[model samples]
Target: MEDTEVREVTTSAAKTNDPDGRRMQLLNYGIQTSIKKCLSAVRYARIEKVLSPIAQSSPEILKQIHKQMECQLQTNIMDEISSMFEEENISGLMNNLDKIIEETSLGPDEQAWRPSGDPSLDVLPHVYSTKLKERSSLEKILKEVEDKNRQLHEALRPRQQRLETLKKDVLKECQYWEEAAGAIPEDYKQKMEKFIRT
Candidate 1:
């Protein structure tokens, strides 16, 4: 019986393809793919973290920052001009000139200058233009993000199928080993088990 079982095992092993080698290859590929995905996720998370403030800021806050930057630039320019001319009153003169220009452009009731009709159209033309551009840019970014997500899902579909196949193959291999173990003599099985444990 032992001789017969040993011959059967050898015959079965000889007839089959190298499933253990294939399984190891698949396992290694899976591990490498997982590590690559983890690295990609980490990179994406870092980029998102860096851009989050810019993406999440309100338009009003952005506008305020723009205004502050312009003010700072103007102040710097005035300082430079004042230093170049060696003039003490140039700063005050520049401020007065700016006030006069603003008054002429905006008039007494700046609110009256707003576009009449739909409340949405009441905003200044330049402000509305900037808002429209911002909206389109955000929409474009959203579309691109959606397209990338869809592409990623499509790309992973094959890998997912392969993983499922690997799982089934592993189970089948386990079943084959269990059947072979069952066919062994009790004393030999115990010895095999002890060897495996050690």
Candidate 2:
């Protein structure tokens, strides 16, 4: 009874994870089929070589030839597997698996799967909430900084205009004084009189 129940449960789990199961099955099937095909090809090549005219009809020579063929077949299989991995770029998959293995082996205190003692350290919610909080804080800080910059610009606008006006007034006064001094009719008394009036 227990065995049947366990079998039913296993079947239900497999059904639920059908996609993962299918992927694993397909990979296994491909590897096994490739190996079988390689063996068949090697067998055919050996038979052909044995029947060929160049085949020295000696047992030792035949054995050496067969050994070379097997090595070649093994090399071909390795090449095929390597090509498959290269095409798929299995490095990322390997990295992810390594992370999973590392996580699994970590101590309870360090594992992210389990709670880390603090209520705020709950896994999924905490991670997402922390991210959201950080995002909102950044946006808030950016907005405040922009507002302060705008306020500073507004405050400086009138002061800048006032400074420009003061500069123009000073330049005009200087020019007038220069012209009046140059126009002093070679008479120091007239110049002193004008200066006293101003």
RMSD of each: 45.4, 15.6
Q: Model 1: how far is 49 from its true place, Å? A: 86
Kindly give the stretch of ten consecutive residues in candidate 2 with the minimal lDDT sum.
19-28
Summarize candidate 1's per-residue lDDT along 1-198 as a digit string, tens digits: 645654555455447853323223333344445554544453433543565776376545655655575566556655675485355654355456656666678555565554578766665665978989999999999999999999999999999999999999999999999999889999998898999999
Task: Please list the residue runs of candidate 2 whose C-alpha ends up more than 4 Å from where it truly belongs after superposition.
Answer: 5-129, 185-198
Query: Per-prediction count of colliding residue pairs?
Result: 0, 0
Off by over 4 Å in 1: 1-126, 193-198
True lDDT of residue 192, candidate 1: 81
Q: Residue-wise lDDT of candidate 2 within 1-198, one digit each (tens)?
A: 645654555466577865333334344445655686767666735665656654545556666777787778877877887788679865446546656776678676774566679886566684897889999999999999999999999999999999999999999999999998888767896788899999
Clashing residue pairs in candidate 2 (N, C-alpha, C atoms within 3 angstroms):
none
Clashing pairs in 1: none
Please report the candidate that would top lDDT against the real structure. 2
TM-scores for all predictions:
0.33, 0.31
